[model samples]
Every structure is written in structure tokens, then in C-alpha cells.
Target: MTTAKNDINKRIQELTKALETKSARLNDISNTVIDETGKGHMVISTEAHADYQKTLGEAREIKSLIEEQKAHLDIERFPRRAERAQLCGPGRRPDRARQAVQVPV
Candidate 1:
């Protein structure tokens, strides 16, 4: 069983890895597309189309990974804060917000 903080950290690491891979793939796709487009006449229709499709696929996969990581982080944090907020309802209760005091005099 993973503690909430540990789970959050693990998810953060996963997200970072995913982001790095996504960035590299995106850059590669962008370079390919731009290079092909720049050479208008020499660029074959099939090659350009293939690069566009690859870029789209990479983007979609990255989006999915990000959403998955976000869900994990949300799930980890939600219980502690969200559950308390729900139980407490809206508006802060002054008693709960402040510590008790004692008069020495």
C-alpha cells in the first residue's frame, strides 16, 4: 500500500518521464513536418501526410498520459481535503478555525 505522499511523488515522476518523451517525439515530428514542407517540390505527398499523422498520434497519446497522471494526483489528494470540506460544509466555523485560550488572570 502506498502512502498518499508517496503515491503523489510516484505519479509526479511518471508524469515527468511522460512529458520528456512527449517533448522529444513532438520535436521530431515538428522537424520532420517543417523540413518536408520547406522543400515544397521535393516533398512527396505520402511523406508529408505520414509525418502529420505521426504527430497527431503522439499528441493524442501525450494528452492521455497527462490526464492519467492528473487523475492519480487528484485521487491521492482529494480524500483528505475534499472529504473534510464536504463534512464541514461551506463557511468556516470559528471554533474549528481557532485554538482554545486560557486566561491566567
Candidate 2:
């Protein structure tokens, strides 16, 4: 379990780095290119937006892996969840004195 968690953490780190690099590239692309009109005009970089979107998708996949890893860690910490639940289950009712009807004294 620890090994799997470590592997997933490593993958998350790699994906984060890749996403940051792509985001930086997009920023660079946005600033590149001056218009010939010499007027203050703004143009959108469709390719850069597409690249950012792809990176976002990869980041979401990484986020899912991270959530899975967290669940794995929780299970590792609570290894006997099933046994604990059985010991203190909601289905089992406790014996109550009020339930036992007493006869006339």
C-alpha cells in the first residue's frame, strides 16, 4: 500500500510539473507577436488555449489519482474497519430495562 501511494505521489508530482510548463508556454505564446497596425489590439491564441485545456484534463486525471491514494491511505490506517463495524453495528439493538414488562409486585 505504501508503495502504491508513493508511486501515485510521484506521478502527481510529474503531472504538476508538466502542467506548469504548459501554462508557462501558454503565457509566453500570449505575449509573442505584435500587430502590424501598431495599434493597441488584442488577439486570442487559440492553440495556446487548446494546449492549456489539454493540460487541465491531465491535471484532473492526476487529481483523481490523488483522491484514490488518499482513500488507500485511509484504509491502511483503519485496517480493521469491518471488524470494528461488526463490534459496534447500528443493526444490533441493546437490551433495555423498559422493554422488559414487569409483572405486578
In order, what lDDT does every prediction score?
Answer: 0.64, 0.61
lDDT of 1 at 69: 70
lDDT of 1 at 89: 56
lDDT of 1 by residue, 2-94 (tens): 576677667667767876776676576556543445666344356756866776687677668767877887777777777666555567543
Please list all clashing residue pairs in model 2, or write none if there are none: none
Candidate number with greatest lDDT: 1
Off by over 4 Å in 2: 1-42, 80-105
TM-score of every candidate relative to the true structure: 0.51, 0.43
Model 2, span 1-105: residue lDDT tens: 577657756765775676567556656766654574669765546775676667667656766665676676566657555555455455543333233433567
Cand. 2 Cα-lDDT: 0.61
State the TM-score for model 2: 0.43
